[model samples]
Target: MTEIRFLHIADLHLDSPFKGISSIPQSKWKEIRESTFHAFTNIIEYAVENKPDFVLIVGDIYDGENRSLRAQALFQKGMEALQAKGIPVFICYGNHDHLSGKWVRFLLPDNVQVFGEKVETKTLNIKGEKVHISGFSYKERHVLEGMHSHYPVANGQHIHIGMLHGSVEGNMEHDVYAPFRKNDLIAKGYNYWALGHIHKRQTLHNDPPIVYPGNTQSRHRNEQGLKGFYDVTLTENNATLQFVPSSAFIYDEVEVSCEGIVHANELINLMEQSLNSYREANGNAIVELTLTDISEETSELIQASSKEEWLSLIQESLEMDHTFIIVKELHVNLPNMERKESNMLLEMMEEWETAEWKHVLKDLYRHPKGSRYLPAIDEQFMDETMQEAKEILSKVVTRGE
Candidate 1:
């Protein structure tokens, strides 16, 4: 009846260029760039302080297909910190960080045990308790075959945990890498399942605690909300899991009402207040503001030649107490104003519906590189966008009364 404690994290994405976010000052980008490292550092510190039996990084320790030496060094540093504290680490590489010939040169700490390219099991004794863990790493970029069939049954009597870095069978949002059905996992008879590949944290099953700890850091706006790891305590009777927040900056989108706002400074004030509220709830955050019900003055401000500069100024001004409220992009969704579709817009819509454009769009959606972050736009959504365009055009035709 002994309890086992460990830290579960995935997708640190070290040295992530954050390709999705663009058009900001280099100084700001530099600060934001360090966020992933900061998050990884936090996880290491927590492991050392808490002295967990082991740390499990399910997959995607690095961001890009080609691993960088700097990212490798930083990862080793974290491993060293845990090793110094007598904590063991288990790692499995996902599609993004699959093993390559280059890894033959990079060395990891002795305390770390990385799974190979085939499904295998490792047995360890922690605090006089025997535990059996099983998993595998992707040898190449794509692992379309079902590896779940290869997972052996749990060893008799020892605590069993299964690790997988792949998408669920029905998850069209992600590539079908190492895809497995939820029932397939349940059939394995493992005490717990640690999943990766998907950046969002989710619990697939509660009884045996099948979970995805999510990524340690958010790389883009698409990965919004609190990004961190899970602290799990397993007992003979029940398993308890707690989410520990370690991300340096939260990414979020906030909408502000400007029904009667007359001055740009007033808008800044409103945004600051909203940012403060977010900080209270989420610690520190990077925000994208969408202003609604914009007055004519605000509309004019939006159309002005210096709109980008003004937005940057607002972002710069929002900095206070070492917290940032960076407006990644500003959207002017004016209320009662027609989202007018001009002749050019109609022409573009027609082009979008054409077979050529559709084919291109599908290719982008199905691209292995993009499937991780960019969700495919569904047919219903495209239809809605077209209808909205027509409504906007009608409004434009009747405006200025």
Candidate 2:
């Protein structure tokens, strides 16, 4: 029986700076970026502890175009830790790390084996078993053709594993690089398939266990969820995969409703309470609060008050006792429909008032040459009308005084 285990990770996107981090205060930016490095350190520590047979990095070792040397050095150091334990590393270049003539000259470590431009397989003899690994380097940013089409089938008595970095069957909003289908991998007859590029953890086939371990750390909001890598254990032909959490700071979207919150202070209190609850649940996670279903009264309160004041209040309240927590505030004013239907007379008046403005404005900008000036003129007009509409609509529909 061939018993082999390995850590599967991809889309590290190392050395990539967090969006908007630089815009923040210099001190805050340093802290945020430090947290990013800390997350990476956690992953490295996990690798050192587990010490798998080998580590398979699918792709995106660094952010493309402006890849950082510091990131490359840190990644090399992390891999060196695993190498110290006599473990080897396999890498396949993704779109971010596209093989260019300039980058080709950089000498990689002896323990690191990167796939060539063409799909090729290499066998590693481990404990009287043949572990066949095959992958291809991304020649350019976008590859329209299927990379898997060129992959060879499982040869000999080895456990065949194929590593790739591309979307399969064109995943949502994913770059159509090296596009392939589910049936394609099954057809290839590889015992295991390790994929990258898409930043969400997914298992395509249970029988063969084709999977994408996702990014080691999330780079943005859209890539939200539990971010981590996978640990796979192979015995003969069967494989078992386990996902390990390696992110240092968790990002969460918490929704706070203003259902019964009529006063601004009441709303702030509720928000503080919600923040406290989220912190308890997430344990030092960074939170983005989405204040939804806000009433017109609430909207007026927000407009009357300074947004910076509200944010400062929450931030201060959150940090009162907790020393190491960061709270990012986002305030949204969603119109309350129930409040709008309370006054019938106000509603009718608003309709008539809006109609009068529309008619006058339409005639003023209705000339044949209107299209030329419409873009600039229409914007201001829309803004004024929207403000008027909000004021009238709020008074007419508000159920409460």
Candidate 3:
């Protein structure tokens, strides 16, 4: 058996205009805007230095189907940089960057290869050993079909790998892209399965190693923590995986205790300490601080002002050096959300059943150009989002303290 080493990254989502950050000043835009590119660049630098056998970018490279020219150019530049180092790159399109939409295509380095809409296998001979990688890209925005069955079973001769940008059947957090089961991939008898779409990295199987490297960068608070890629070494019998942190700016959601604080100045001091400590441990971070068990006076003062105003005050008070800690949002003594809804929330949900999705998305479907590529609304996706919508709305309507 031949040993193979490669870097696996997914959901680069380059050129993502991070939402919920409009309040940030124009000067801060440079870091927030360039973070995605910076994240990917770090990964490329690693591949160049380490000299992996190849690189695997599973899917959803671009944020959307209509990718920006800058994003395309930057991506090609990274690919070319790898080509210079004699490294190869493999790519597939996820639902977010499906092939259906019209966009400008750049001339990529010959070392870069992209999987087509049909399920196909590409073989590589490294160190006189055969390596086969099987995958497919999304032609349409929604791929409800289970393409896993189309994947060729491993021949058991050398090394076989699978790349899929999809969610598991029961995963309701992210959109259902190319859906599959854990058992389905195991049945393929591949040495490794490189997955994408879900922003949080996970290990589905241990032995042969089925994994999701998560997104290289984060675009929202929901995709929190240290984001990065995976450096994998595979053999016929087993695979070893190493996670490499690559996010230039990490999305860190911190809940700080306001146990003994009375004055607003005290709160600021505590937050400053916390931020500095976090920055020391991790690199630069975009933090959303949640204050708990605050004094009555502080609560009144917090209630008097909006979160935005509080956040602005917090931002202005901080004096951070190069290892910066940006307070993106502030919340005051909010109760923890419960999975089981209260009577009042359950009553409100009764009316939601009568709601129609067609009425909600009528305008988008009616558009002359949009209707061309738009498929029917995914029912599973709708049901999932509905639950999230209920949860989000419940927090507002049922909140007391």
Instruction: Give per-model TM-scores.
Output: 0.82, 0.81, 0.81
Candidate 2: lDDT of 123?
A: 74
lDDT of 3 by residue, 216-277 (tens): 88788888888999999887666889999999888888888878777777877888888888
Residue pairs with clashing backbones, model 3: none
Query: Best TM-score goes to which candidate?
Result: 1
Give one digit per residue, the lDDT tens place, for model 2 in 1-401.
48899988888877667874432234455655655466677777887888888889898877774566677667778878777777888998889878862442346667789898899887787787888899998887777788888999875456889998988785677777899899999888878899999888899998888899989776556666568899999886578898998776666678888766678779878987887777676655556677777667677776677776776677776667653445565656454534544355445544555456567567665787755576543446656756776676676555222
TM-score, predicted candidate 3 vs. hidden true structure: 0.81
Provide the lowest-lDDT 10-residue window in model 3.
334-343
With candidate 1 superimposed using the best TM-score fit, by how many Å does residue 219's alpha carbon deviate from the native?
0.9
Clash totals for all candidate models: 0, 4, 0
In candidate 3, position 206 carries an lDDT of 92
**Candidate of highest lDDT:** 3
- Model 2's alpha-carbon lDDT is 0.75
- lDDT by residue (1-401, candidate 1, tens digit) is 47999888888888888754675545578778889999999999888999988888898888866878878888888899999999999999988888863542477889999999999998889889888889999998899988888999875588889989998887878787999988999998888899998888899998788899888887788889999999999998899999998898878898888777777677678877876777787777777778777767777756664668767776676654456556788766744344333656667775675465457577676778876786446677677767887777867656532
Considering lDDT, which of the candidate structures 1 and 3 is the better prediction for this target?
Answer: 3
The list of candidate 1 runs beyond 4 A from truth reads 101-104, 295-306, 319-322, 339-401
Ranking by TM-score: 1, 2, 3
RMSD, candidate 2, Å: 5.6
